[model samples]
Target: MPPAHPFDFGAIDDDEGDTLHEECGVFGVIGVTDAANFVALGLHALQHRGQEAGGIVTHAPDVGFQSVRRFGYVRDNFTDPETMAMLPGQLGIGHVRYSTAGSKGQTAIRDVQPFFGEFAMGGAAIAHNGNITNANALRRELIERGSIFQSSSDSECIIHLMARSLQKTIPDRMEDALRRVEGAFSIVAMTRTKLIGVRDPLGVRPLVLGRIGDGWALSSETCALDIIGAEFIREIEPGEMIVITDKGIESTYPFRPKRPRFCIFEHVYFSRPDSILGGRSVYETREAIGRELAKEAPVEADLVCPVPDSGTPAAIGFSLESGIPYAMGIIRNQYMGRTFIEPTEQIRNMGVRLKLNVNRALIRGKRVILVDDSVVRGTTSRKIKEMILDAGAREVHFRIASPPTAWPCFYGVDTPQREKLLAATMSEEEMRDHLQVDSLRFISLDGLYRAVGESRGRDASAPQYCDACFSGEYPVEPADMVEQGFRPKTAAE
Candidate 1:
């Protein structure tokens, strides 16, 4: 068969089915020269958050509102001079999507974001990261009240709600819309002359403000700001919204603020290592997690090897803390895309090995300690373990940076069904046996909190960050999931 078209994302199977995926990334800029270009760069930096599809919306007096939504990476779709020229504007917003809701593997163009809505005042386009827990109920209610939706995306619910609002300004309409919303959201929206950003009351996802030249930018991560040479201004506080235009910026708390419970996973894996989260370096935090793991679960091993890329920082810390030699025991093929086709069945069965090969020279006869960010399904971990043993390793040990993910994340992360999550079904010992590793250990939930700067660890009275995936103590009720018969953890559980 010939290579499928890039935008034919539905035809492709996910290459990284074992890992969690963030729903999307949002970026917007105002008053910059060709702001769309800056948004593109910002989106490119945030490609790790979402790789399935991307969209950019730009507004100029000449063009009014112009948008391009396409499947595949930003570089693949948005870098062309012709495409960039078409998006000419001094204000723009963009989204890169990995489907958490809507069409699953088979994404339609309509589902790709920077969703635009026409209002009585003007047209506004909004790019949103994070999932709306009450989207289904809201969607049903909105449809009953005569709101027509254009896409299967939950984020589009906001646009429709904005349309129905009695408020005069777009920002006011958004506040009205979001006040009715339940679940996590970090939004970057653009009107003809304004750029706006808002974080959900819980701040379950990330949104940062940055300054680039005379203009300002809002992005999902500070790393994105670095990509566009934007100075990090600070994170958008939970429940806060900022409207930026030539007159400068105005900030407000649209929703009642609750105790902040930012997504802890952003520190573990979702964010770029170079990014800063809650005034701490993501890389440094991961390193701290490794150090904590070493102290908590001390293991004797000949070599401490990272699972590659994401695992490297933690592995370095583990090696330093444990006084074990650090080596690259597994090598990743950097050029490989998440999905690829193999001509033969034999080649197809190679699976994870096609993407990661065991570094035999380093693995042979060595008791290797493999440090990985997280284990979701355990399929990838099992396969990697087998590859290591096949390469003549003396023993294989698995050190996971985060605690086991036992619950599905409803707030913007693409997670497997609860039953499908290996951690959800198995205990630590059972998981170790299932993977057939000599030993396996995950950083304790408290240890993870300490890594992220909670020196005394997670406070049971009121946990600081969202660790629902590990602890099953959801800070926000997943209304949509509960309506579908999903169970929440009881006190005993």
Candidate 2:
């Protein structure tokens, strides 16, 4: 049988011109009846991680394996009974995605994962989160060695590498494939009888294990587990791989040990507040960040206001710590998806107004402190400042939960290049002037570490988390990017 052509229904083009884009989310389950249904629910909870496309691959004893890939939101496609009916199995893996490594437009459907490969050992479907920085170099080598590529995704390189491995078992082959690869990866893969989960040596992305009845599941966040009524087991440790079968789960350490560099932004903006990460509630961590921000960057304001949803918890913490009353100054439109996930500037600008509006009554004659997750391009911040001032805010003070994002992220989060980042090119005063805020303050890097339970603060030599976006100290060397003349931006620059 010939391969199925990539599905390209109409494109869903919403724009997020100023915010950072999340990489992708992966989910897998084994030993369950109607496994695809649980995977759908898990994907729904992780929809915020990637809004562009979603795909699921499932294997059944009698029916073999099936896959369904689509462009647009998961709820739009995967929620339907008709779509779910096409995918039925005892073992399944799914992915919700935004392309950081592939082309855009209708053709991008080819890059939507969980990519399946029919290896000589049988069939394996892999769903990956986090970028493979050295993918191009590997791709060239693989192509030269007579490997035919299917998709433009960096992730496809893994499948090709696995095909050539001398290992007998699928798990061993996968481990062999990953050993040759570099950069951050948190992967969930499914074979006929087993579900496999692996996190990279530094664990730049998150992958967690869960239990549902007698079945086992792996997901990008604990929130996905909650949606499927799965009991949280524990996080998949860095450099670790787990293979789950009906018999039991087997663990393997495939990579040399290293200090884990979990992405700290997960607590700041990527994760849902309801999720737990690194053994702590993400909501509590953000709240602590807000309290720390208040201590480090105090300002006299009449009302402490969050930028809605993402900033609400931190704003509440700021209010408690600073003795300022909290109010709903900026009201988010619950009906709209995130503006940052949109693909164009024009649509993103329109989305900002459709997504958020100021509460005139709450802000009128008040010195409002706007607590936001982070400022990227300064476009959204500028627009919000204008909206607040127009609504009769006496003064608008900006407080950011995370430190200024000054560097691009290669390990998953889709940050702009250094030249495009507002912080990368401007000082705090310059950013304040550009955004036209009365004052702009970001939480210190030490404060962020403290909030995430690192009381002694970040060590310059060995940081606790992957803070490359703020500190420019990458845990993994970006070999491919460096070869292309990508240089890390210095603070002075």
Candidate 3:
């Protein structure tokens, strides 16, 4: 493809680190008039969550459960008439995966998900999002008892556990299986006549249930509901399970449940602006963060501009609170893929310019307030600050909505080492100099919680949130996981 663009990665900055780990995106449909089509549409909306591989498995009276998968984007892998025609059924499940536990080099059609396994007990097809913290330990235990593993995913651990359970019915076995897993996960598994969805005990990931006429759908985000014309239903409670069939949907929880600890990063960096999470609007939550930022770190500037996409709502709130006009000071190129790990420095440097550009007309000669969700390594922010100054911004005042990320995340996010994080090593003034900005302010940790807690209908007042990346109190100890950092390894190194 003509060597791609030089600005694709090198010119980009390491400050573009993902704040949290995302396992994959999941979509399931039952009783839908066009189950395969609905799954296809839902997977399209969740495309940003993962891009390594995609697949769907469907169940019908004639074929039971038929599936097709390939290592590519959903549009490229599942768009053909031949592929879609093979997945005919009124019930189905889909998955888009970005590997966390296994080597991406081993990626093949067989390894792509909706893993179908048949045994003396029953047959099931499963798709999962989020990593199971106990997967490696559990996998070792399962292997000792004669369960053969066909894939390198933690997801297969659940199915093997379900197989080992002595329960006679599928629901009972599923319940037994879930109680054994720990960490963040939203799973959808289907059989010939039944479909089931389950969330981890802490509910660190998002999963919602929706209904469209007689058909029912379950997804990782409300955006899927919008795509399929499904009416909004409540979110799946932490430690809850729902079973769906032609008879309708039924809920259950057979394990001792814990309070929900939804990943706070979802509200900050992930999720679409139009979506609602934990009974709160995502956009409003971010705006509240911005409002709190203005109160906590009032800045002097003529106008406020967000990083684009994720930073827009917070920028708007900051502008309103500070009485600074919000303008489109930076424009994002939506077509640019994520550049967090572009191989070369030159490519990473070019990435900053390709991903976003300073709108000179809006920012020139103004005292600009630049707001972004979070800063990781500080490379891109530095480049951006230099770009704006070159464009005639008199002074650049930087504002961040979240506290400094000093710790690495083990849940599923691919964060780097502690030393690599800018906030962990640099003083506030040092960061300003590093980014070449006039002034800088980061929101306090308490302000973030208050923003969510005080929102009108959110009831975010008392949610158990995973703030380990911001604070040092990780729900689970991850000292052993320090060796698993994302520092690209080479043969000689």
Candidate 2, 268-325: lDDT as tens digits: 9999999999899999999999999999999998999999889999999999999999
**Lowest lDDT 10-residue stretch of candidate 3:** 1-10
Candidate lDDT (C-alpha), each: 0.87, 0.87, 0.78
Candidate 1 C-alpha error for residue 420, in Å: 1.3
Residue lDDT tens for model 3, 1-493: 0111101122223444433335478999999775888998998888767777888999888777788887767887777788889999899999987654224344556667888777566688888876666666677789889988877667788889989889887777878888887767788888888888988887888999999889899998998889999988989888899999889888987657676678888888777778899788999999999999999999778999998877899999999898989999999988776434545766666767877888999888999999999888787777788889989999999999888877666666656566777877888788888877788999888888888883222244555688877875666544224323332223362
Question: Which regions of candidate 3 fall more than 4 Å away from where they truly are?
Answer: 1-21, 100-111, 337-349, 454-462, 479-493
TM-score preference between candidates 1 and 2, better one:
1
Candidate 1, backbone clash total:
1
Across residues 1-493, which tens digit of lDDT does each residue of candidate 1 receive? Answer: 1111111123223335577778789999998999889989999999998888999999999879999999899999999999999898899999998874224544579889999988889999999888888888888999999988778778889999999999999999999999999889999998998999999999999999999899999999999999889999999999999999999999999798698889999999899999999898999999998998898888889999999888988999899999999999999999987556423667667778888999998899999999999998788898999999999999999999999998888887877677878888899999999999999999998898888888433455555888889989898888877877789999898
Lowest summed-lDDT stretch of 10 residues in model 1?
1-10
